[model samples]
Target: MSASTPHRPVRADAERNVARILEAAKVVLAEDPTASLERIADEAGLARATVHRRFASRKALLEALVAQLNEQYLRALHEAKVDSAPPLIALHRVTELVMEIKFSHRLVMDVVTAGTPARWSYLSAEVRERAELLFARLHASGAITAAHPSWCLKIYLAILDEVHHLPAGAPELASCADEVTARTTLQVTTVLGALGGAPLPH
Candidate 1:
């Protein structure tokens, strides 16, 4: 069975177990790229056989994580109302939302990239297409002054990478909503500067 797509309806208990297993997998795999199902099960407080039953193999588990991340990425765009909000408001909101998601999932993302399944490639393309369209709108609205609208997309992505690579214990990443807000603000400001856009209004 493809972990990314379950065929049967999952019971509430099974759903809870699956959530636990995925959370544990992210923590374990993030710390050790080669972490095993056994280790993940231990982290989740479940038996090895239980995790095995939920996810047949490590690749399957990774696929499930990719699927979850894709959902969050798309949700971020939707919540930002990229198509309907004012161009600058949408840009700032989307950047902050995406940055938070990326920051939280940086560890899980490392393992998910070890192998790229077709589903992930397709979902990734969809995300990029949406981002490109958002950039085109930003360009037309004068929110970004890049020569080509595509350049804004490139620069925005590059800024996200830089934010992801920040020191693990950076103060901006402290476990508080205000810290996250600070980090996202810094990220949005950097992207605007890089793309030759004016600063966001206070």
Candidate 2:
């Protein structure tokens, strides 16, 4: 067989542009999944031709967003130190981290989850495994007593799914830092309570 060509590294400016486009796409598409490439280009402050040259089509751009979401979830899990932190602390940290991502990328998440379910299923399975392991730790630590680890994990994930369905652009919730903090606090409390854990102090 002939040798396969090695992929070239992206130039720094090109890499920066890609990052810019992806961030802009997240913001714009979260507000409107039907947003156009020109709209995204405007949001990114780049030439329309630049975005078209980078993504080629809306479907191609959504694919890139899905890939970005996958990396982000993995990073969040790593940063949460789910494997090492105390179970309650780890649970609180991961829930908060995931909430930030899901809130910012709601519509993009909905579109991709509906159109490309398999992409998220792969990530979900890994996240589920890690989360269930955390729940097992919680159970061992006596934070959860009434349910199995798998069951607790299901409840936690369900809460996250429900949070994803909340209003992404509601000004009262979006613009107020206290509201966001309260929402996350409620989410953690609900998960802990539903999983039979004592609530952490505010």
Candidate 3:
């Protein structure tokens, strides 16, 4: 076998290692955005040398983490089927999924913003479409008398932002079924009230 051929597998293995490190970086940094590379390496079960070889500096690591955050978030939006459910159900389910995502991925909630990388813009557009579908359904059913769809969309998103805020630190709601249930109730109740939608059956 050619000597060059053997080196190919080594490179492939190195790439896989980098991916693992970045995923671990997501978890570590979400809990503490300033976490050290050594801590991240520990999270990845990798040597510091392996992580440094992939990311030369903290800035490089953070940039990679942002990209990873956007990718995972967009994927979660797809998995949530934000546009496929009935109007009210879509609002509740999408809110639930987004809460789960925000709670699970601290990096995503921390880094995603108005000026996030251009590639992530489509995710926001899809979310707005979800809002439009929901409000449209409410209008059709005579459930809301919102005269301006744009205003209603703004209110919907604003409520979502407040409900999912993580001011102290990244959320730890992933494992608590009772907390998720309570938050889901709060989310549905507040958003529905804000949008003038009728109360759903308990």
Backbone clashes under 3 angstroms, per model: 0, 0, 0
- For TM-score, candidate 2 versus 3, the one ahead is 2
Give each model a TM-score. Answer: 0.78, 0.71, 0.63
Q: How accurate is candidate 2 locally (lDDT)?
A: 0.76
- Candidate 1, residue 68: how far the Cα is off, in Å: 0.9
Q: Hey, what RMSD does candidate 2 come out at?
A: 5.3
RMSD of every candidate to native, in Å, equals 5.6, 5.3, 5.9
- Over 1-202, each residue of candidate 2 has an lDDT whose tens digit, in order, gives 2333333334667888999999898888888878998999999999999999999998888778877887777788888888899878887888778888876676567766667644346355676677778888888888878557777866776776765556655542445555456557667887777877787845
Error of 3 at 31 (Å): 5.0
Per-residue lDDT tens digits of candidate 1, residues 124-163? 7767777778878877888778767556776776677677
lDDT of 3 by residue, 42-114 (tens): 9999999989998998777767765665565556556655456555665566667667766776454554342
Rank all candidate structures by their TM-score, best first, as comma-separated numbers: 1, 2, 3
As for candidate 1, its clashing pairs are none
lDDT of each: 0.79, 0.76, 0.67
After superposition, the stretches of candidate 2 with alpha carbons farther than 4 Å from their true spots are: 1-10, 47-49, 106-109, 116-125, 146-151, 163-177
